[model samples]
Target: MFTARRLSMVAAITAFALMAGCASQNPYDPNTQAPAEGGVSKTAKYGALGALAGAVAGAAIDHNNRGKGALIGAAAVGAAAAGYGYYADKQEAELRRQMEGTGVQVERQGDDIKLIMPGNITFATDSANIAPSFYTPLNNLANSFKQFNQNSIEIIGYTDSTGSRQHNMDLSQRRAQSVATYLTSQGVDGGRVSTRGMGPDQPVASNGTADGRAQNRRVEVNLRALPGAQGATSTVQ
Candidate 1:
């Protein structure tokens, strides 16, 4: 009787161990650390961690091939970040090339890029309508944006201090909308574009001199990649 009881207790313990093993076999939690294959930076590391977490969650929700799914998701996220960094660098270089001597200032703040255009190119005096000559440059820009399909474009118009504040504001808003419309017509996704007018509120140059007025009466185009489309690269212009 004693030996039989001992044997029964051993069997119970074995069964419990097996059950625990099966219960703990979580495919999504591979505990696999991302290997530093290359010179990965802190930004890349954080991005990878976030991607891994997202992948694990997604795989768990799917309830199918969770381990494989998580791995693939993490890898994709890492690759995308690396690709975006490379693409952004290339784009900055290309922008410098195209904007050289154009008198337009290009600035990148965080993920946003700004292109400032002189008013003479965008509109005629006191007119909200964009100039015919301006279409070429704008078209070229639109073409460049086609490659970066996931980015949004914002057009902002401004005017000199020649007109009433209200009038200038209205004209500027119209001008901005016009540019947005033109970009949409040029094959840019309308959903990814917006427009606004600053009137004379934001002036990069003085409104006193002819040249300064010309500069003040201008438009600005801001570009930023939409969420989930980061690291994707395109050659539009």
Candidate 2:
């Protein structure tokens, strides 16, 4: 008898086939709807097929992890943190434009931008190595950071709570380190970048389901303001 993991793997393969069929009949849509009055209009910057394909670590898409959706269009910059906000906004716009149709989402969180890379595509089956297919996306991201050349970069790695703590945590650390290494290799300042591994911690979805597990195994790149620099691009390492 096939285990749940095996069953989920089969299901994922099916989803890919179905997705291809769907794409053949229709273009990938972000499925954006008009914003409510005085509210942000949610726009999914990533392509539908890619996102579906990426998240299906071997199961259907987990809607619960997608969040309320991304805020579309340029957000108004406030007076208090106008400089940081504007900088972040421009970076966000550039990232979204660059990563369009890549199944990678660029979202705004207050004064920062969160680049969410689905783990299914990012790493392969408990491996810390970044998949070849994922390199282009990371390269594009590195280029964007180079262009912006400001703010601190924090790469956080996550994993589903399946394996032992030591093993999972080690895997997470290596994954985060791998991303940081890639960015610095692309000429992003090393000192401005840091890596953290949060294995099985702060899960965005339940671990009971395969879809949720796939969603939980993710890497988040957070761009934040440099301490005391007040959003200035300080050359560090």
Candidate 3:
């Protein structure tokens, strides 16, 4: 007989496989939301896949009563979905508490969490090096990230339109990588993290004025939960 833990692992793996096969684009990418073929949300589609996987796992696990095993497997997956939501909520609350008074602003959007960190606090002008003062907050963030280890992290760096586009892009990439390096050095899983540089793009404010330019040169960290709370988080390595 298969253990419940083994069944859950199988279900998660199967659901992810189904999602990856069905969508040409990445379903778990934070930058894009791929449309479903029949108006079904990705979550719903994956939920159904998980159910199917559970049914299959349950049947295989229970030799004498396959039907009963299938039902139990599906129920277990449903429960895991609910559990994921609960943990997500707790993680958001903990992040908000930890980031309070730290120059970082935590914003929750749907199932995703965004952290905006101003450039002045994160680095010196035209430099990719992290400011010494910012280390404490980054450390705190690393602790929270380790505690809530199921979410994939995306660190995006941006810059004002001051220098050549190529220069800005390289600087931005270095800045993003700097943050990623610090987090991983603090024991956060490196495999769960990715970084991108969007130089002089998607500015939150106008670049004409000093204040607007200040706002434009900043970094954003986005956290997106992976499927199945019981499964370890994995993303681009």
TM-score of each: 0.63, 0.64, 0.65
Per-residue lDDT of model 3, residues 101-201, tens digit only: 88888776656779999876888788899999789889999999988888899999999999999999999999999999999999999999999999898
Candidate 1 deviant stretches above 4 angstroms: 1-78, 231-237
Question: Model 3 off-target regions past 4 Å?
Answer: 1-78, 227-237
lDDT ranking from best candidate downward:
3, 1, 2
lDDT of 3 at 122: 88
* Per-residue lDDT of model 2, residues 190-232, tens digit only: 9899999999999989999988988888899998877653423
Cα RMSD for predicted model 2: 20.3
Report the Cα lDDT for residue 230, model 2: 48
RMSD of each: 13.6, 20.3, 9.7
Query: Which candidate's lDDT is highest?
Result: 3
Q: Give the CA lDDT, 0 to 100, for residue 142 in model 2.
A: 87
Provide backbone clash counts, one per model.
4, 0, 0
Clashing pairs in 1: 84-231, 143-236, 144-236, 144-237
Encode model 1's per-residue lDDT on 163-199: one tens digit a residue.
7999999999999998888888889888989889899
Lowest lDDT sum, 10 consecutive residues, model 3, at 24-33
Candidate 1 least-lDDT 10 residues: 26-35
